[model samples]
Target: MSKFKKKAEVKQEIPTSSMPDVVFMLLFFFMVTTEMRKSSIEVKQQIPKAAQLRKLERKTLVANLYIGQPTEAKFGTEEKIQANDAFISTEDIIRWVNEEKSKLAEAEREQLTIAIKGDKDAKRGIIADVETELRKGNARKVLYTAADNSNARKN
Candidate 1:
């Protein structure tokens, strides 16, 4: 071949040896940053204020029960009990508690604490009904979640 003769050159391609590393890095980034919501709150609530406030020892062993006015007009303004994402009747609190407990390990079940988060404007009768249901469920521990007085209640 003459020194001046043109010749076909090999095509240069991007190296993919690092593609897996990049993909895995992205996967780990999302896994670490993404927060998966376990339940949605459909009620309007302002947790009551308390003189004393303490955090739970084991958050994993707690069942949350919410009592507040429905955010939707269709659900009416009456305070409705919410277990997980749906509105539940006071009579169903026992069942709801059992369902929540079932999600934990056997040892954690006994230590399960029923956390009642209620609206400050909610009626005491409804809360009393919830207490009755909790009694029916035989909940060993119950915690009434309230914000410290230092934290002003939202209007």
Candidate 2:
């Protein structure tokens, strides 16, 4: 009975040294696979619905420009242009485009496209102004984003 008790006292414990390694692997996997939002949108933009819409193949090559009314009442109900997280004037569009263009490589400059997400009720003149600024900055590639209206009848 003493010998049996001694054998029982000598117990083998499962090693947990690799537990941290396993946890770290899972953390790394999620970090690599997750798509983080690059910028926070401050404006409220209800993009127009469209029957046909195509997704951008490369997210890195796209810069988002949001146009809509301010989400907060203090900012007024008038429509505005938002670049990154702040409201930008039409005159500032040129500067914003240049800044974004500078971030890209020379070869990639031509490939970079500005994705304009304007509200359905926003003024068309503002859209045209944004386009003109884009051209002035030598960033001519522009993409207008619209919500997919999959239920719409095809002609």
Candidate 3:
């Protein structure tokens, strides 16, 4: 009777093999749905033609500079930085550039770059002013992006 009772007992617990599959599925779902960072402002500028531009493998950091019509001042002017008492200045551009440069590794410092976004209607003087400020802030490697053209075959 004891031997028969022992044979009838059943062991019950969660299996281990399926746990890894569940974890992997969760990770894959998040990866596929992750959102990419985008510029808060848009530009309508014509990107200068470059014959020797090489594709970058990755972007470590980015500082956005919006060049367009001067911003309107409001009643809460004291709380914010204003430009020329009528427009918002490009003062923060340098600071942001420096912040991005600081994130580079010792060996990758030379590879740091800053992308400039300028509106089509924006004056060349504004762009030049922004460029001068960037140069003063030690950002020499600048790349200007253009609208995407999609008429090529996919490899």
Candidate 1 stretches with Cα past 4 Å from truth are 1-35, 150-155
**Most lDDT-accurate candidate:** 2
* Candidate structures ordered by TM-score, highest first: 2, 1, 3
Question: For model 2, where is the 10-residue window of minimal lDDT?
Answer: 146-155
Write the candidate numbers in order of decreasing lDDT.
2, 1, 3
Candidates in order, TM-scores: namely 0.72, 0.73, 0.50
**Ten contiguous residues minimizing lDDT sum, candidate 1:** 2-11
Please write out the lDDT profile of model 3 over residues 41-140, one tens digit for every residue: 3223344443444555575644445555433343332222222122245676677666667777777766666666555555677677777877888887
Q: Which residue pairs collide, candidate 2?
A: none
* Predictions: Cα RMSD each: 8.4, 6.4, 10.5
Task: Score residue 86 of candidate 1 by CA lDDT.
Answer: 86
| Top candidate, metric TM-score | 2
Full-model lDDT for every candidate: 0.85, 0.86, 0.58
- In candidate 3 the C-alpha lDDT for residue 47 amounts to 46
Native-referenced Cα lDDT, model 3: 0.58
Query: RMSD of model 1, in Å?
Result: 8.4
